[model samples]
Target: MAIKVLVVDDSALIRNLLGEIINSEADLQLVGAAPDAFVAKQMVKQFQPDVITLDIEMPKVDGLRFLEVLMSARPTPVLMISTLTEAGADATIRSLELGAIDFIPKPKLGVAQGIEEYRSVILEKIRTAARSRVKTQRTKVKATSHLSYSSTEKIIAIGASTGGTEAIKSVMEAMPPNAPATVITQHMPPGYTSTFAKRLNNCSKMKVVEARGGERLLPGNAYLAPGDRHMRIVRSGADYRLELHDSERVSGHRPSVDFMFQSLVKSAGSNVVAALLTGMGKDGAQGLLALKQSGAFTLCQNEESCVVYGMPRAAVQLGAADKVLPLEAIPEAMIQQLEKVKAGSRL
Candidate 1:
């Protein structure tokens, strides 16, 4: 049976376009289209859709408000449709925190042109959302006592997708103020990465910023790969700096985890700690394996704690990860592994 999807938007044009795109896919069935949240609530009972494509702005009730209600009540997979502006980016990130599976940016151009341009992305998000597990209750992250460690030469590389926003936040919050240099690649569109990085910065003791080319890596700070760019680590004498460039998408993502991990395997080798977090696809598996083979410490998030286990599952199957840990346990695992590396180096 085809995956059943419902389209919810205040605009008739968007509703029609979404319906058309969904109908065009052989594996997707458009169950219903609602112009507002009021209509959407009724259709949810009537059609019983497998996934919902929600617009952030809607008549009667807003998308975020409705999403909160729906997740609390029914816990269905929801993919948000948002504009590509700064305000849109912030709202979309909030939606993810509210249990949305993912979001796609609405084109800035006219509806018809934008829909046609982003048809593939929209369809793929729907498929991914349909297969995702929706949680009614989000994990509450408690602030733990921070560990105090002097700056070390270790670098931590992390990659995440689907449910990574919260997962990354949990790990970052648990880290000490003097945590080692960190690099991250989360599958997000262009406008949202800066906001995501800022949000992470606010919650964690470490400084977090979106990677701009040529910035030197510093202990106690994390660099997030900017959307639409591939970020690689390069050595500058005895120090490390980032190189961001436009490149073909790897594993279906531009700032791919594989790209960053492979670069680390070449530059940092045994000095790196890499973790593959929750995501929907196998983007980081091969690069993680390469990192492990190069003597870097590698870890993967366990399935039970994952929002979507695709990436970590691939790494585990490929024998890439040295440890498989729950979300709450990964920070300590990384710290322990890094300490082991430090001890071995002294010996």
Candidate 2:
């Protein structure tokens, strides 16, 4: 059966173009094109689409409000249509927190050509969304275990995509203020990572900032891979520094989890505790396996806790994860992993 999709945008042009795109694919079916929330509500009831493409700046009720209500009521997988501007990025992240499956940015240049260029990505995101779990917004759950990792010898690495922003927030905020240095690569477009880092910093006990290469990896601080750029860890004297690379995309993403994971395997794998979280592809699977083989403690978010169980699922399949855990349990697991590594015992 074709995956049913609904286009919900105020713009007639967008609705038509997106409709055409869906119809062009034999595996996708256009269930409805709604111009506003009122019409969208009726269409949603009438068609019960498997996936929905939502615009943030919809008339009257805005996408976020609609999403909150929808998630609370119907809880369906939704892909937000967002722009690349600061405001757009903020709204896009907010939508993800409200239980949206993922987002696709609007073209920056020629609308038709730009969107056409992203045709494959858009289709892939839609297909992934269709298979995604629409997670409910639960009260923030903080880690209950005591965290005491204060050594510069320990490193924590994380890789995520799709539903990662919220997942990252959950774990980061639960970390202790003096936690080990952390590195992250969350699949995102250029110009969005800065905003994301700032958001994470605000809620997290540790400082979080966008990686700009050559920054010392300090305890209680987290470095986020700059969007579209690869991040690597390098040892300088007695300390580690985060470095950025302009190399070609690895595992289909520039800031690939695999790229970051493999770099740690070469330098500090034994001292690292890496976790692969919710995403829509196998970008981090091989790299995670390498980390595990290099003696790093690796973790994969369990399928039930994942919004899109692609990356972590791949890691689990490859036997890359030392433990498969739920999203909420990962922080405690990381701390435990660090203790085991510190004691130099895999047991």
Error of 1 at 133 (Å): 1.3
Model 2 C-alpha lDDT per residue in residues 76-150, reported as the tens digit of each score: 999999989999999998898888988899887788887788889889999999998888774365664555447
Q: Against the hidden true structure, what lDDT does model 1 obtain? A: 0.88
Q: Top model by TM-score, which number?
A: 2
* Predicted structure 1, TM vs. truth: 0.95
Worst 10 residues of 2 by lDDT: 338-347
Clashing pairs in 1: none
Candidate-wise lDDT, in order: 0.88, 0.89
Instruction: Enumerate clash totals for all models, in the order shown.
Output: 0, 0
